[model samples]
Target: MAKFTGDTAKKILANEINVQTLLHQHPEYQEEVLRELSIMKGSYDLKRIQAMMNKYTSSAKLAGNLIYKSGFNEKTVNTFLPNIIKARMALHLLEHASIAASAQSPTKNVRFNLWDGMVLQRLLFSKGFERKPVSLGLFNFCWKFVLNKKILMPLVNQKGIYCFYSKALIRELIRLIGDKKCLEIAAGDGTLTRFLNDAHARCKATDDYSWEHYITYPDFVEQADAKAALFKYTPEVVLCSWPVPQNTYEKHVFKTSSVKLYIVIGTRNPAFTGDFGAYNEAEQFTMELNERLSSLILPPSNENAVYIFRRKEH
Candidate 1:
């Protein structure tokens, strides 16, 4: 493994070093970079991360106290909002550093420090505030809390970070999808379908289980690709969450004869998710943002949208 100096870590953090190119040339180098950033005691990068944790600690405490005292009422909301923002900023610093070191080699985990674990545990799985699979309250808590993004974005590989499904989004979808059989393709973990089923919506979850490294495919999520699921289920409404950017599979959704309404939960940023080319080329459908559903997609800061595609009335 190549020795990653403090200067090298600094260069990576500054975007001076082309990590992608470096990784392409020497894939083993990524491990070294991750080690230096996360494991090397007294390293500059580690110190920077520790400093950010300190800031996050102070801010989270202040925000948590305000919420505890006033129950996050209107008057207390504004007062603690600044502290929440500060916490987010502090966590972002760690996120940036983790991404800078590990994005190129995505399969390798970004190990968080001891302090990071405590902060993240409180943010994700705190008692009395535990929102099991998905909830608007949970999403709001995560969005308002800084440590949420830090723990989620950095600790895991890219495959782990999918769209956060909110109860509001699911409820809105249930209303829009009334009477229509819905199917979710690429259904990682099958959590969404579990929620939808609980809401009594007729939706089946299916996936090829390709991302098994990070995603746990429940038995409810039938093992199949997008094309296979669409053909077998033959649902009227097809749903997908964060389809791989510019992937070939999603075009199959447009081709399926029974799919009249296709809903995609993803970022508007074309480079981030979904195949815009397929969406544009699929002339038989009229695609537009479902404004109400879009607003319901959780965490608020993720800037995700719920896109609706209806077969044109020919």
Candidate 2:
């Protein structure tokens, strides 16, 4: 790793060199560059993220209060937000690093010490603030608190609290999916993908790398949109969560012959998340609202539901 001083760090932070070229020319410096990038000013707005969570979720008020009371003036917020932003970017950077490092050294472990995690890890485990997995139960607590805490924790710590889909849900998915390959699309930050992989599920994640504000495209997540990923991976099972409202890409999942099961986690209220239109119109598969598979997630408004689609039998 190149030793970067104050001047060089500032220059690097200012985007003085094209990041793409820098990475290509000095792949060894990717991790250091990413660390600098996190310190540089970034575009993530905690208020915006919090607003979305506040509007859509209700799971962690006690935790939220702890964050809101953290005495942040303008300067503090400015400096603090970058650290939070770094945590988000590290999501991609660490993944790419793992892949690069692993090729040369299989045990290569890339861990992050994030700024945000330091402020919020303790609060996540506080009582009266557990996240509910079922959709309808999502609205009962402050999900904004939990989500921000989660995003921030990664900024400061390598090991912290993690939420996953319930074991029963994972087991059911595994049982139905069997030994088939699985793919998750638009896998924001890949929390669920990690959960699946931890359980030894034959799952991989792909994304179009659209959320540039929060992350750089990770090498591990194949940088393809839904259609392209479907064609390339040709997975038998597809997974997605809260797809863009009125999304267009999910339709491509069913169009592929290799896909037999599509698992979606979103609201049952159905204001058009995950190409529900395509699922409704398609005749080849049957859709069911799975209550049993809704464990171990933040339902946000107690309205979260997992829609499971299976190919029709002859």
Candidate 3:
């Protein structure tokens, strides 16, 4: 990480410098951001948080080449997601500091634009990213208007080390269980799938495409429901990130004969991710909280957890 001075930090906060410069220099810039954010109570320099994330996400795709260039199963680098997650969570709380704030009834207008799709495709072929830590630097930049929770909160959540953490966890998983096909169901953007694929993990991504309005589903991702994907791919290892609560497709994974193990990346909040209903109801598999894998979840929250379900044939 580069030595960032208070003056340099101020300039970054003001957008005088490119966010990529900061991200490349310091992957763990989130902590500095939060520390500085304490003093930026009424400022709005964070307006560009959305645009910066757009570029960061694109850069993440480019970083895959670097990651792939590293030897297979090699842990190339660490990500700032733990700090980033905490910073974003704090930023969100800061954005809604007032008790009078109320949730807006979500409308159909919730959607992504062409930029989302455009960059996603470009990301697939992009390369030659800088050789340094990539940080979103949302907190690093100063703002221009009063922070708008409605517009910025989603980007803060959507953004961050989406492409980085998966590489670490998946490599660990495949290292544990070698010589098996892997399938990622409910793969929202296929970010994890792409990294794992690049790392030589025989993994393919599939999603039901229900969040098309919210996500620009990558061309690499097969547009199929989880159960159908399990049947079609017949993978031995199954993984999913943030599967919707009460979803049934994951339940069908166990029904498939080829699936020997299932892995889930989700929140500690019981109702936030994956299918607790299915995990609790099933009798054929042994479930355990995978601390090592879960510990790698971005933002490193108590809410993040990874579960491994190994089948026990009767």
Candidate with best TM-score: 1
Write the candidate numbers in order of decreasing lDDT.
1, 3, 2
Tens-place lDDT digits, model 2, residues 1-314: 23333344333333343334455655544554455545424433433333333332222223223333654333433333333223333433433332222133222243224533332333332222222222223323434434343233233222211233444566677777778899999876565676577668888888776555544444666767787788888999999876754344778788889998999876664432455668888789999987766544442235657899998988
Q: Supply the TM-score for candidate 1.
A: 0.58
TM-score of each: 0.58, 0.50, 0.52
| TM-score winner, 1 or 2 | 1
Weakest 10 consecutive residues of candidate 2 by summed lDDT = 153-162
The top-ranked prediction according to lDDT is 1
The best-first sequence of candidates by TM-score reads 1, 3, 2
Task: Tell me the spans in candidate 2 whose CA falls farther than 4 Å from its real position.
Answer: 1-164
Local distance difference test scores for all models: 0.63, 0.54, 0.55
Per-residue lDDT for 29 in model 3? 60
Query: Model 1: runs farther than 4 Å from truth?
Result: 1-151, 156-159
CA lDDT, candidate 2, residue 286: 94
- Over the stretch 78-108, how does candidate 3's per-residue lDDT look in tens digits? 2322233334334333333211121221422
Taking the tens digit of each residue's C-alpha lDDT, what string does model 1 give over 1-314? 23334344333323333323455555453444445345434333544564555555566567657755765465455555434434433343344443344334343355555665554455444243222345666556555545334445434435454445566777788887898999999887776677788889999999876566556666778988787778888999998887755444688899999999999998786645677878999899999987777777644544677899999887
Model 3 lDDT, full chain set:
0.55
CA-only RMSD, every prediction:
19.0, 17.4, 22.7
**Model 1: colliding residue pairs:** none
RMSD of 3: 22.7
